[model samples]
Target chain A: EPEVTQTPSHQVTQMGQEVILRCVPISNHLYFYWYRQILGQKVEFLVSFYNNEISEKSEIFDDQFSVERPDGSNFTLKIRSTKLEDSAMYFCASSEEGLGNQPQHFGDGTRLSIL
Target chain B: AQTVTQSQPEMSVQEAETVTLSCTYDTSESDYYLFWYKQPPSRQMILVIRQEAYKQQNATENRFSVNFQKAAKSFSLKISDSQLGDAAMYFCAYSPNSGNTPLVFGKGTRLSVIA
Candidate 1:
């Protein structure tokens, strides 16, 4: 079965540095999302993207975060400045359509470690 | 706002035994979707099963099944003939049936299958 794929399974960056996490959603998927989980915490929604624009974002998704669908297949999340609290597992998910009734498929998360 | 709650933080089951994980949610929306996702040690989030709020029939996938109580806003996952591979972190998530809604996830229950 086709699945969402994320690059740089583990990323280590210095505090205050910029980091970009990349994802390649299923070819036919129309909606994409980014979520994060602090160690021992619940997974929290970050942002949702559709039609090359952000559809919705959470309070956690502040000024530092931005998402882009730079190409037909690649969706990326960039953090302008990494903080120590930013250390967590970042996950990418996608669904065939934007309607919430459809199941979203998640990728193996990228573990972001800020030093 | 929708909130998913997983009462049990951890659970253990003997191999081949049946185990149930409890999940409850508070949502104002009449139509939505509930999902159970499994994350193994690798931390790959895998969709185990999903239930549509409008459907009265329970959703089942092979050995995995759900008891969905729409009126009570309760959804529980039942794993039958549990195996060693079933040891993982299980998350209960909810999403409204709206355009591009992000999934809201519970804190998750850690399930351990003992041999």
Candidate 2:
């Protein structure tokens, strides 16, 4: 019953500052993803990574956002410039294989608040 | 682009009762996966159930089951003999291409189980 784990369950950052959200995906997973849910809004896709590179990303994942598997187990999302609209609960997920039947398991989200 | 919609913003059911949360999606791709994720007060996204578009039979897992209508582009979750723990925000999601792609989620429905 391994699970994805995220660091700093709550993060408060000043506007225009850089913030990194870290996550340790399940050990054997091959695909990783980042999603965020703004209060009262739907969960939005940010980015997906595999083979040590970004496989796909949403429009929300613009130039300001970047993801890296800096190490074997850690996947990090970095926001170069934070804004009030960037505040949300960020979730990390991983899947053994990115197949239609293989579902992704998510970590307890990191609540990010940009001032 | 694919979009998942959860029409009901909130639903309530008495303990030991049954409740069904509706979900519909708009996708042109013939092969895709549908999922239901439950988020409790802790804000952890937990996978509840899943369905493959190619499967003609509906998918069921313990007390959780899905009524999937591929033609109608509908995937609904039914919680039988609901318990208090079933109270959470339910999000219906869609994943296309069966590759390292991101999940598209619905706005989510808040389920409240009364004791």
Candidate 3:
């Protein structure tokens, strides 16, 4: 089965530095998403992307966060200024369609660690 | 707003035995989707099963089955003939029927299968 792929399984960055997490969703998928999980906490939605635009975002997705589909296959999430609280497991997911019933395929996740 | 709750923080079961992970949600929307995702030590989020709110029959996949009580707003996952590989953190998630809505996940339940 095809799977979503994320790069830099673990990322360590300075508190004030910028960080970009990359994901390659399934080739045929049309919708993409970003979610985060704090250690021992529930997974939180960050943003959803479709047609190169953000479809929805949570309050947790503030000014510091932005998502871009720079190319056909790569979707990226950039944090303008990282903070200690931003350290978490960032996951990428995709679905064949934007329909609610479609199952989202997930990647292993990128563990972001802010120093 | 939608919220998912996994009351059991951790559970244990003997290999070849059966176990159930409980989940409840608060959602005003009549049509929605429920999912159970498993995350092993590797932190890869894997889709275990899914249930549609409008369906009266429970969703089952092989040894994985769900007990979905729409009236009670409960969706539970049952693992039959558990194996050591089943030891993982399981998350219950909910999403509105709208394609634009993102998923809301519970804190998760950690299952430990003993040999």
Models ranked on DockQ: 1, 3, 2
For residue B108, model 1's alpha carbon misses the true position, in angstroms, by 0.6
DockQ of each: 0.90, 0.79, 0.83
| Residue A5's lDDT in candidate 2 | 96
Q: Give the winner by lDDT: 1 or 3.
A: 1
> What is the TM-score of candidate 2?
0.97
- Candidates' lDDT values, in order? 0.95, 0.93, 0.94
Q: Pick the candidate with the highest lDDT.
A: 1
Which prediction has more favorable lDDT, 2 or 3?
3
CAPRI grade of model 3: high
The collision pairs in model 1 are none
Model 3, span A2-114: residue lDDT tens: 99999999999999999999999999999999999999899999999999999989999999999999979999999999999999999999998877788888999999999
Q: Estimate candidate 2's RMSD in Å.
A: 1.0
TM-score of each: 0.98, 0.97, 0.98
Model 2 chain A worst lDDT window (10 residues): A96-105
Best candidate (score: DockQ): 1
Predicted model with the maximum TM-score:
3
Error of 2 at B97 (Å): 3.8
**Candidate 1 lDDT, B12-100, residue by residue in tens:** 99999999999999999999999999999987899899999999999999999999999899999999999999999999999999888
Residue-wise lDDT of candidate 1 within A1-115, one digit each (tens)?
9989999999999999999999999999999999999998999999999899999999999999999999799999999999999999999999999887888889999999999
